[model samples]
Target: MSEFAFEVALCALLERERDEIIARQLGASVHGRRIMDIVCVEPGPDFAKRVAITPHEIPDAAIESRAGVGQARYYRNCFDMHPDRARSVAERAIEIGFFERVRQGSRLYVRQTARYPDEWFGKLVGIENKPDLAVPGDLELQLRKDVSLGVFDEVILATESYVTGAHLNRIPDEVGVWRFRPETGGLEVVREPTALDPAASGVDIVDEYAGRTDMRVATAAEKARLRRRMAERAYGKGWRSFDLPPCVHGAAKTVSGADGIPYCEWKESVVNPAEECGPACPGYEPADPPEIDIEAVRDRRTPWVANPKGPRTQSGLDRFL
Candidate 1:
C-alpha cells in the first residue's frame, strides 16, 4: 500500500483507539511548523495547554514584540481580513488575557498583555511513521534531532516493519519504537521513550541548514508560544478536518472499513476522502439526495456566534464530545 494509504489507515484506527485524546494532526518538516509525522495532543487546563481555535489575525513581529501591548485599532485592522471573526477575537483577546482593556474610549483602545496562555496543553507526543524501516531515509538524524529538541514530552517511531536487534541498534535509544500492524490496526511497543526536560535541554527551532549550521537553543517563552500555537491549530483543525467531496448522491458518506480506513460505498473501496471527489472521480454518479446539507465549517471555537455569510460551524468542544 502507498504511504498515504498507510497513513490514512493508521489515522482511522487512532481516531477510535484514542477517542479520549483531545486532538491529532499531521505534520511535516514545513517552514515555521513543528516536525513530526503525527502529533497527538492531550488537552489540559494549564495556560500553556489551552489554545483558542478562533482564527484571529496573529500580530506581526512589530506588534508582538511590543510587550503584548497594542491599540484597539491595531487588533481591529489585524483582523480586518476576517471581519466576521474580528469582534469575537477582540472580545476574546481580553477574556483570555491576550489583551487588557485600557479604556473603551471613542477608539476602544487595549493593550496586548499575553499572546497565548502559558499552560493550556498538558502533554504532547510526536510520532514518526515508517512502514518499511529498511528503506529509512535520514531516520537516525531525524530521531536524534527530536531527542535533542525536547519539545515533545515523548517521541515515538511507529513502523510496520519486523522488529529486530539490528533495527533497534540503528534507532536512537531515547526514542520509543512501535511495531504497527496495518491489517489489524494493532500497535506493539518495542521500546519506551524517555521524557526530556524542556527547560534544561532546550529545543532546536530550525533544522540543520547547509549541512553545517549553528543550533540555537529556544527559550522557555519561545517554546511556550510555539506549543500554544500548535495546540490551537490541532484543536481547531483535527487531522480528519477536511471537506468531503460532493457525490452524485449529494454528500459523500464515509465509514470505517475492516482495515481501519475510510470506506466509500459509492466507490466500493477504501476511498481517500481527504482529496476532492466529484465528476473527476471514476465513481461519479448524479443522483443528488433530497434535503442534503452542503456546507463547510472552518472555525470551531464559537458555534453560537452566527456566520450567515459563511459555512456552517461548530465548537471544538462539541466535536470532541
Candidate 2:
C-alpha cells in the first residue's frame, strides 16, 4: 500500500475533487530533483503567490548594458554590484524571502516583487504515481520522459491497478490513465490526456543522465521561462510540503488519520510523509510532532484558493500569456 500510501491517497483524492493547484516533490533541482508524483495545478493567477522574484544581484545582462533598458531601470542598474558581491546577493536575497529592502528617494533598492497575474497559469497536470501497474518501473522510460518534456499540460498515469487490457499495452500512448481508489476516493478516467505544447514542444532542461553536468538546451524562450518557473513553484509548494516524521515514543508524536492522514504514533499505521518518516526510520524513535494549529493548520493542509488574485492586484502576465 506504500508508494507513500498510494501517494497520500492520491493527494486526498486530488484535494477533494479537483479545484487545482497541487505540488508534491516538484521538478528537477538541477540533476537531483525528479520528484513529481503529483502536480495538478489549474486554477489561474497566483504567480507563486503574486510574484515577488527580486534577486538580480548583478547580471540582468550586466544590468541591461548599464541601465538603458526597461521596467524603469534603476536600483543602481540592478543592484550596484561589488560592495562585497552586492552585499552578498542582497544578504542572500533577504534571507530567502527573496529580496526586499527598499527606499526610493534616497535610493536603496533590492526588490523582487511579484503580484503578476491576470492569468498566470492554468492546466499543468503531470501525475505519475504507480500503485503497481504490474510493477512497471521505468514505465517506458517514464512515459517517454513525459511525452518528451512538454512541461505538463497533461501527462498522467496514476494507478492502483484494476484497468488492464495488458495494462494498456504497457503505457505511453501519449500517456494518460488514472484508476486510483484509495478506498473510495475514486479517480478513474482511464485515458484521456494529450495537450502539452510548451511553446511548440521543447522542455527537459536536462534529465537524460549519463555523465551529465546539469545538461542544457532549452528555448522556446527557455521553455517559456522554465514554464513560468515551474508554475511559480507549483503555486507556492503544496502536496504536503514534506518533512514530518518524529516519534518513537517521545510523546506529542504523530497522529492525524481520517482525511488529515499522517499517522505513525509509534508505527501504528500510515507514515511516509516523504520516504517513510524520520530518524532514518527503521521505525525511528524519539518523538514530538503533532500539535497542529494555525487555524487547524489552515483547515488541514491548505489546498490553495485564498485570494488567488481577486481584488485586482496586478500583472496577469498580459492577460495570461
Candidate 3:
C-alpha cells in the first residue's frame, strides 16, 4: 500500500479506538525542522474548557500575553512582539473567540473570553510511519532526535514490514514498534515505549557534519511552550486535512468507521489527491469534487466540535467594539 493510504488507515483506526485528539503532519520540533506523521494528544484536566473556547487554534502569542479574563487591557501592552505582529495575533485571537476586544477612547483593548487552560492537554504521543522499512530513509536519525528531544511522552514507529533482529537492533530501545497491516486494519504492538520526561531540558540536534554535530539545549520552559502549541494545533487541525480530488474518479472511502478517506476509482485504492490527481494522469476526467463534509465527519467520529457557541456572552454591541 502507498504510504499515504497506510497513514490514513492508521489514523482512522487510532481515532476509532482512542479517546485522545488525533492529528497528522504536525510540527513537533522546538527549533529544528521535524514534522511528525501522527500525534495523539491525551486530554488533561481542562480539555473540555479548551473545546468550549474555540473550534480553531488559539494563537500562542495571545495565550502568552498578559490579557486577563477579569479586565480588558490595552492591546499594545499585552504582547511583547513587534507592534504589527502583536496586532495580527490579537486579531486572530479575537476572530477565534479566544479574545474579545473593545474600543476605549480610540485605543483598542482586549481580554481573554475565558482563562487559558494550562491543563488542557496531557501526554503527547508521536508516531512515525514508514510502510516499507527496507527502504528506510534517515529513520534511525529521526527516531534518535525524537528520543533525545523528549518532546513527546512516547515515540512509536509504525510500519508494515516484517521485523527481524537486525531491524530491532537499529531502532532506539525507548521507541516502541508497531506492525500494522493497512488492508486488514490490524495493529500489533511489537514493543512498548518508555515514557520520556517532557518537563525536563532536552537536546536539539541542529546540524550534523561528517564526524561532528551541532546541538542546542532546549530549556524545560521552551519545551513546555512547544507542547502547548502542539496541543492547540492538534485540537484544531485533525488528520483529514486533505480535499478529495476534483476528478470523476475521486470518491470518499470509509476506513474503520471513519469517513472521508480519499479514494481513487481508477487506482482502486486510497490515493493522495495532491500528488496523484490531476489532468496529467490518463484516467483523470474533469468533474466537481465530491461533496463531503469532512468537518462534520470529524465531529461525528471524534470529540472535536465543528461549531460551538463562543465563550463570550456579551451583548452584540460588545462583539463589534
Per-residue C-alpha lDDT of model 3 across residues 140-195, encoded as one tens digit per residue: 88888899899999999999999888898998999999999988889999999999
Q: What is the C-alpha lDDT of each candidate?
A: 0.55, 0.57, 0.88
Error (Å) of candidate 2 at residue 64 is 15
TM-score of each: 0.63, 0.33, 0.95
Q: Predict model 3's lDDT versus the native.
A: 0.88
Tens-digit per-residue lDDT, 1-321, candidate 2: 778767877776676666555667677222223556788767565434343332111222222223221233334555555655765555554454444566677755665433234354677777888887676477666666666666677888888889877888777777888888776666789788877776664545345566653444445665555555665666555665654555643222222222445667567666665566656767576666655432344234444332334223334333322
Q: Among all windows of ten consecutive residues in candidate 3, which has the lowest summed lDDT?
A: 312-321
Candidate 3: residue 266 lDDT (0-100): 94
Q: For residues 1-321, what per-residue lDDT tens digits would candidate 1 score against the true structure? A: 545456656665665666323334544222234456777666455322133322332332222433344444444555534644654566666654456666555544566654444454567777887888878487777777677667678888888988899888988788899988876777899999988665543646355567674466766666555555655556544554444434553343333331223344665555555563566777767543323222231122122121222212233433422
**Model number with the top TM-score:** 3
Instruction: Indicate the residue-level lDDT of 86 in model 2.
Output: 61
Between prediction 2 and prediction 3, the one with superior TM-score is 3
Q: Which window of ten consecutive residues has the lowest lDDT sum in model 2?
A: 55-64
Q: What lDDT does candidate 1 reach at residue 121?
A: 56
By lDDT, is 1 or 3 better? 3
Task: List pairs with backbone clashes in candidate 3.
Answer: none
